[model samples]
Target: MRVTMIGTGYVGLVSGACFADFGHVVTCVDKDPSKIERLERGEIPIFEPGLDDLVAKNVKAGRLSFTLDGAEAIRDAEVVFIAVGTPTRRGDGHADLSYVYAAAEEIASLIDGFTVVVTKSTVPVGTGDEVEAIMRRVRPDGEFAVVSNPEFLREGAAIEDFKRPDRVVIGTEDPRARAVMGELYRPLSLSDFPVVYTARRTSELIKYAGNAFLAMKITFINEMADLCEKVGADVQQVAKGIGLDGRIGSKFLHAGPGYGGSCFPKDTIALVRTAQQYGAPVRLIETTVEVNDARKKVMAKRVEAVIGDLAGKTIGILGLTFKPNTDDMRDSPSLDIIPALQAMGAKVKAFDPEGMREAAHLFTDLELVDGPYEVAQGADALVLLTEWDQFRALDLAQIKNRMNQPVLIDLRNIYKPAEARAAGFLYSSIGRA
Candidate 1:
C-alpha cells in the first residue's frame, strides 16, 4: 500500500517509519519545513531507539521518504494518515484540534477519490465526524472515508511496540474504508496482531480511557508509596504483592515522582475536560491529575528535606527527560521539580543522555552537565528524577565523595535505603523508610 503520514511528531514519525518497514511505500508529510528538511537529510528530529536506523534503511530502500507538501504526499496514496498533534488547549484542558482540523481542511481540498483517511493521532470522541464534516464542507464534491486509528506507542519502546502491537483498532462505518485499512495493515495481519474494527466514537474513547487508566495506576502507586512511608512499609514490596495478581499488571506500578511525559498529563486532563462537558465526571481521574501535579514539587521537597533546605545549595539532577531512551521533555516531572528547586535558591545542575539538548532550551537558567558524575561533583545532594541506566549502578561511594554533603534522593526508588545507608550517605527516597 502507498501511504502518506501527516505530521512527524513522535507517534507520526514512528508510525510512518514502521509502516514503511512493513514493506509499504510511505511518504511522511510535515508542515514544518525545517523538520521535513531534516528528515530529507536523514536527520531524525526526535530521539527514539532504533528509529534513525529504521528510517535510514527504509529511505535507502526507496520505500520511505519525507516532504513538506502534504498535497504531494497525499496525491497518489491509497491511505492518508492524519497523524498531526492534538495538544492540550490553553486553559481549557480540551485537546487543541486546530492542527488536526487544519490538516483535514488541507486534505479536504485535494481529496482525489476512494482514499481511506485515518486519524492516527489521539483525538477526542466525535473527531472523526468533525473531520468528515470538514472534508464535505471544503470539497463538497469528492468521496473520502474518515477512519479512527489512534496510536499507543510508549516513547522508550516505540519501535518494539509498533512492530509487535498487541492489537490494532480501526473505527469506520464504510466497508470499503475498512477493507482499505485492513489491506494497508495486511502485513501485520499475519503477525497475529488482532485488528479490532469498531465504531469511530468507541475507538476515540479507547485511546483516552487507556491513557487515563495508566495515569491513574501510576498515581495510585505513588500515593501508596507515600502511605507506605508513613506506615513503616516498603512500597516496592506492596507493588510486587498487588502486581502478582493477573488483574493488576506490574507495568507502571513503580512509584516515581509522577507520570509525566508527552501523553499522560495532557491526555488525562483532556479526558477530564471532556467528561465535565458531557456531565460525566471521572472523580478518580480528577484526583489522579491533582495528585500527580503535586507529586512533582513534593519530590523537590523530598530532596529539600534531605538537603535541609534549597537555599544556597547546589543540587545535581541525574536525569532531565520524563523517562529514558527519548529526548521528549513535554510535561516531564523534572520541568516542575527543577523550577521548584530553583525557586528556593538552589543551583541545579542536570544531565540526561538524550534530553539535555531539548531540556536545555526549557531550562536556560540551570547548568546542564555531560554525565552523571559531572552533575554530582561538588553538589550538596544528587537527585535521581529519571532512572537512566547509567545512574543505576554507579560507584555509590565515589558519588558520595563527589557531593558536598553525602546525600542522595532517589525519586524513582532505583536504590534501596539499606544500600545507600551502607554506602555511608544520607539517602532519602519516595516510598521507603
Candidate 2:
C-alpha cells in the first residue's frame, strides 16, 4: 500500500519506517523543516532503540522517505496516516488538536480519489468525526474515510510493539476503509496478531482509557508504597501478591515516583477533561491525576528528608529521565525534585545514561555530571532517581569513596539496605524497612 504519514515525531517516524520495512511505500511528512531535513540525511531526530538501522534500511530500499511537503506526500498515496502529536493544551488540559487538524485540512486539499485517513495519534473520543468534518470543509470534493487506529508503542520498545502488538484496534465505519487498513497491516497480520475492528469513537477512547488505567495502576502502587512505608511492609511483596492473581496482572505495579512521560500525564488529564466535557466525569481518573501531581512534589520532600537538611547539602542524583531506556525527560519526576532541591539551597549534580542533553535545558543551573560517581563525588548523599540498569550493580566501596558522606536513598528500590549499611553507608529505600 502507498501510505503518507503526517507528523514525523516518535509515532509517525517509527510507524512510517516500520510500514516501509513491511514493503509499503511510505512518505513521512513533517512541517518542521529541520526535523525533515535531519530524517532525509539519515540522522534520526529521536533516540529509539534499533530505529536508526531500520529506517536507514527502508530508505535505502526506496520504501521510506521524509519530506516537508504534506500535500505532495498524500497526492499519490491511497492511505493517509495522521500520526501527529496531540499534546495537552495549556490551561484547558484538553488535547491540542491543532497539529492533527492542520494535517487533516492539508491532506484534504490534496487528496485525490478515495483515501482512508487514519488517526494514529492518541486523540480524544469523537476526534475522528471532527477530522472528517474538517476534511469535507477543506476540500468539498474530497472523499475520505477517517479511521481511528491508536498506537500502543512504548518509547523504548516501539518497533517491536508495532510489529507484534498484543492486538491492533482498528475503528472504521466503512468496509472499504477497513479493507484498505487491513491491506496496509497485512505483513504484521501474518505474525498472528489479532486486529480488532470496532467503532471509531470506541477506538479513540480505548487509547485514553488504556493509558489512564495504566497511570491509575502506577498511582495506586505509589499510594500503596506510601502506606507500606508507614506500616513497615515491603511494596515489592504487596505488588507480588496482587500481581500473582491473573485478574490483576503484573505490569506498571513497580512503585516509584509518580507516572510521568509524554503519554500518561498528558493523556490522563486529557481524558479527565474529555469525560467532564461529555457530562460524565471519571472520578478515579480525576483522583489519579491529582494524586500523581502531589506525588511528584512529595518525592522532592522524600529526598530532602533523606538528606536531613537541604541547605548547603550537595546531593547526587543518579537518573534524570522520567524512566530509563528512553531519553525523554518531558514531565519527568526529576524536573519536580531537582528544582525543589535547588530551591532549598541544595547543590545538585545529576547523571543519566541518555537524558542529560535533553534534561540539561530543563535545569540550567545544575551541574550535569559525567557518571554516577562523578555526580556523587564528595556529595553528601546519592539518590537513585530513575533506576537505570547500570545503577543496579555498583561497587559500594567505590561509591563510598566518591561521596563525602555515604547516604544512599534508593527511590526505585534498586538496591538492598544490607549491602549499603555493611559498606558503611546510611541506606534508605522506598516502602521498605
Candidate 3:
C-alpha cells in the first residue's frame, strides 16, 4: 500500500517509519521545512530508541521518504493518515482539532481516487465525524472514508509496541475502508495480534478510557504510598500483595511522584471535559487529575521534611525527563517539584542522560550539570527524581563522600533503605516505615 502521513510529529514519524518497514511505500509530510529537511538528511529529530535505525533502513530500501509538500503523495496514496498533534486547548481543555481538520481539508482537495483516511492521533470521541464533515465541506464529491485508528505506542518503546501491539483497534463501518486498514496491518494480523473493528466513537473512547484508567491506577498507588508512610508499611509490598491477583495484575502500580508524559495528563483532562459536555461526568477521573497534580507539588515538601531548613541549601536532582529513554518533558514531575523547592529557597542542579537539552528550555535557574556525580558534588541533598538506568547502581559511598551533607531522597524508591542508610547517609524514600 502507498501511504501518505501528514504532520511529521512523534506519532506521524514513528508510524510512517514503521509502516515503511512493513514494506509499504510511505511518504511523511510536514509543514516545517527544517523537520522535513532533517529527515531527508538521515537526521532524526526525536530521541526514540531504534527509530533512527529503522528510518534509515527503510529509507535506504526506497520504501520510506519525507516531503514538505504532500500534494503528489496524497493524490497517489491509497491511505492518508492524519497523525497530527491534538494537544489540549488553552482554557476549554478540549482537544485542539484545528490541525486535524486542516489536514482533512488538504487531503480532500488532493486525493484523486478511493482513499482511506485514518486518524492515528489520540483524539476525543466523535472527532472522526467532525473530520468527515470538514472533508465533505471541502470536497463534496470526494470518494474517501474517514476512519479512527488511535495510536497506543509508548514514548520510550514505541517501535516494539507498534510491531507487537496488544491489540489493534480500527474504527470503520465501510467495507472498503476496513479492507484497506486490514491490509495495512496484515503483518500484525499474520502474527496473531488481534485487530478489533469497532464503531468510530467507541474506538476513540477506548484510547481515552485506557489512559484514564492507567492514570487512576498510578494515583491509587501514590495515595497508597501516603497511607503506607503514615501506617508504617511499605507501598511496594502493598502493590505486590494486590498485584498478585490475576485480575488486578501489576502495571503502572509503582509509587512515584505522579503520572506525567504526553498522553495521560492531557488525555484525562480532555476526557473529563468531553464527558461533561455530553451531560455525563467521570468523577473518579476528575479526582485522579486533581490528586496527580497535587502529588507532584507535594514531593518538594518530602525533601524539606528530611533537611529541616531549605534556606540557602543546594539540592542535586538525578533526572529531568518524565521517564527515561525519551527526552519529552511535558508534564514531568520535575517540572512541578523543582520549582517548588526553588521557591522555598533551595538552589537546584540536575542531570539526565538525554533530557537535559529539552529540560533547559522548560526550566529557569536550573543548573544542568555534566553527570550524576557532578550533581552530587557539594550538594546538601540528593533527590533521585527520575529512575534512569544509570542512576540505579551508582557508587553510594562515593556519592555520600562528595556531597556537602549526605542526604538521599529516593522518590522512585530505586534503592533499598538499609543499603542507603548503611552507606553512611541520611536516607528517605517513599512509602516505607
- Per-model TM values vs. the true structure: 0.98, 0.98, 0.99
For model 3 the TM-score comes to 0.99
Best by TM-score: 3
Candidate 1: pairs in clash: none
When 1 and 2 are scored with lDDT, the better candidate is 2
RMSD of each: 1.0, 1.0, 0.7
Model 3 segments more than 4 A misplaced: none
* Candidate 3 lDDT tens digits, 260-311: 9899999999999999999999999999999999999899999999998898
In candidate 2, which residue pairs clash?
A: none
Give per-residue lDDT, candidate 3, residue 75. Answer: 99
Q: Which segments of model 1 are wrong by more than 4 Å?
A: none
Error of 1 at 232 (Å): 0.4
**Which residue segments of model 2 deviate by more than 4 Å?**
none
lDDT of 3 at 301: 98
Residue 101 lDDT in model 3?
90
